[model samples]
Target: MRSVKTLLVPYYEHPTERPDAWDALLAAADRLYGVVLNPASGPGAAPDPAFAVVAGRLRAAGVRVLGYADTDYGRRPHAAVVRELLCHRDWYGTDGAFLDQVSAEPEALPHYRRLAVAARTAGARTLVLNHGVHPDPAYAELADLLVTFEGPWDAYGSLAVPLWTAAHPRERFCHLVYAAPPDAHVAAAVQCVVPGAGVHPWGTLPHALEPIR
Candidate 1:
């Protein structure tokens, strides 16, 4: 089956401080389906009111925002920590939650399962687990979609692409990377991996993978 494509747009501006950042995002937003409000970096850090300010604007502009909560950022228990994040859905009015820093261990699946269930119960329409590597089939089945590979530009072609292509139904996967690369790089990567694998260009603009296209 062909996969759906999506681009990951940043929560707000670019990390490098580009003035055209908002324009770039708005221009790409209509071309994509969703955006991720990642508070993990940039101005997303806590005590920075920019997250809410930017996320609110994105929502008003008609983009589906998914909050990024890095479980590994603080070396704490994910469930208890994530349970607190669920409230962000209400605050941000986001469509779902994307759990970053996901563990790859088979034993970790149970914890993720619990989180997935919690996300749904909290009325999250989507749940994404960022495993940072090619998804294990067992882990893939647990969440709505899995973030299989998140690495540097140099490794994207040699490592991530091959690892991703080996898996089928790429439509249900996500690749999170910096946007310093061109759109063609993203386009090619998406096509080479899973015809339908969603691309998070600049980690925000979401373009659906349409195999038929």
Candidate 2:
């Protein structure tokens, strides 16, 4: 049941900037596990009115609206991170949190565990950690979904999934690939494959969910 959403979209563009892309995302809401809303890459200095509207729409469509939280690979202060998560919740009424730049080492587990606890205490119903690689198998327990793979299309085929992944349900993992081939196939439980590449890959809508004209 946790694996119901097959796509975890991190479309970073503002709704006003890309109205069509946001419209397309709304049209494909049924297939989304969640959409990561990055208002100035961590809620900005204050709340964004546009993001709030989009979040409301996504929630109405039965899609989890996740607020983006950058961990700075655990270097950022914990309180700062929590503040961002809270801002996402209070400002946009997001039901989930997308913790990005997460550290994948076993030693960093305690730090993340604490952060995860803070997130839950603050009312994040769904938590996703974007480790961007197959982290220590134990990293799977700190959040609801682990982004085990994140890269370009050319590097995806050569990826080697860790055997430890077999111990957990596939739903526990997600893959994010940009500049992906038109016929790309991702065997993971959840994914976000986009054709847009360069400095920012997530700004474009996934081709699979082409805007409903």
Task: Give TM-scores for every candidate, taking all chains together and pairing residue i with residue i.
Answer: 0.69, 0.96
Worst 10 residues of 1 by lDDT: 188-197
lDDT per residue as tens, model 2, 1-213: 443569899999988888888888888877898999998989899888999999999999999988899998889999999999999989999899999999989888989999999999888999999999999888888899999889999999999988999899998899999998779888888999999899899887778775656
RMSD of each: 7.2, 1.9
Q: For model 1, what is the alpha-carbon lDDT of residue 42?
A: 19
Local accuracy of candidate 1 as per-residue lDDT tens digits, 1-213: 533335644343343444245545555555444566655431132433545665677677766677767667324575655655565675666677767778877766777777777777876787777777765468776777777776555556665344534565656766655433344364332222221123533433323322122
Clashing pairs in 2: none
Candidate 1 residue runs with Cα over 4 Å from true position = 1-5, 11-20, 40-50, 73-75, 160-168, 187-213
Candidate 2 TM-score versus the reference:
0.96
Error of 2 at 64 (Å): 0.3
Residue-level lDDT for 76 in candidate 2: 91
